[model samples]
Target: MSLHPRRTGWRFQWVTILWLTAVWVLLWGDVSWGNVVNGALLGVLVTTGLRMTPVDFHGRVHPAALAVLLGRFALDLVRASFEVSLVALRPRYTPRGAVICVQLRSHSDLYLTLTAELVSLVPGSIIVEAHRLTGRLYVHVLDVETSGGIEKARQNVLDQEARVLRALGSDAELAEAGLSRSRRAREVAAR
Candidate 1:
């Protein structure tokens, strides 16, 4: 099934409307009825008048996979926080960091953007730059002691991608993303 379906009748972009309304309220520093009405109108106008080509998406949402991904993220978040704290607390601690490149499997702009944002949000690493055409991300990692560290970082990116795909991608997307046979097998085992 297609991700963005055509509207039949008076169907509108409710998500866009809500997002614009939220932004408007934040910008105005108030949440009045007038502000909401204006924001809704603005959203309608922008979405309809300034129309951009809709993104083509074919991924399916798997709730179980999403739950697992969220659980892993929470654990990683805590672990990273501690690791960063340890580095910060140490005296004369110089960060052993390097810019590591990770190539993404999926070419979807949505996946690329979400993955970059999610990776950057995690402590100890940040996306320095992303190549739109190549779907590659140069991430600045906190530690890269040796070749092994680079491999670890690369594997971490792959793992993150796999989890994200499982959470939000269809089986076809999973294959398209080129996840390892072992990882792919695990998904079946999970079901």
Candidate 2:
């Protein structure tokens, strides 16, 4: 009943072999027939000993969205650095700090991890904790000017999540659905 060949095992074995060969070439930089043979043997041995893990391939992501996210992150880094420098130079002028919670709409663990990493990389904010159950992120911010500070931080997280969703090729309907779910959850929690 199956049209595909039973080649999964062979494919994995070959991957292991290729990986070992590449590693050998990098480590020694000597391209000889002996080295190639040895590397191939080593690869087969190692790959066989190691367990194979399945790869998760979702829909194709847009390269342009990724570029945009990278650019925005770089710009934010520069701007945050300047702000942090000013804060450090004048400690007295630094506003009071507070922690803000951001609820993520995306269900992907990778996206959540990336967003947390990006937020933590900024100058004045740090990710305190991520709730595994709800995908809510708690971030501690260095400067807090007014009551709106928390809301501002929440907005920044949402904006970053939107960019990631776009990069992952999610349609407008999915995006709206995620936003609605997140909003409803927040409201329920508040009540």
* Clash count list over all predictions: 0, 0
Q: Looking at model 2, report the run of 10 residues with the lowest lDDT sum.
A: 1-10
Q: How accurate is candidate 2 locally (lDDT)?
A: 0.72
Question: Per-residue lDDT for 1-191 in model 2, tens only?
Answer: 12232334576557667988988877788998888888888887766665544332243577877788889999989988987777778846747899889888865666677789988998888999998678899989887653247788788887887766666634553445354224465587579
Alpha carbon RMSD to native, model 2: 8.3
Candidate 2: pairs in clash? none
Candidate 1 lDDT, 87-189, residue by residue in tens: 8888997878999899988887778887888788888889999997998989999867532498888877777877888888877887777653346696886
> What TM-score number comes out for model 1?
0.77
Candidate 2 residue 107 Cα shift, in angstroms, is: 1.9
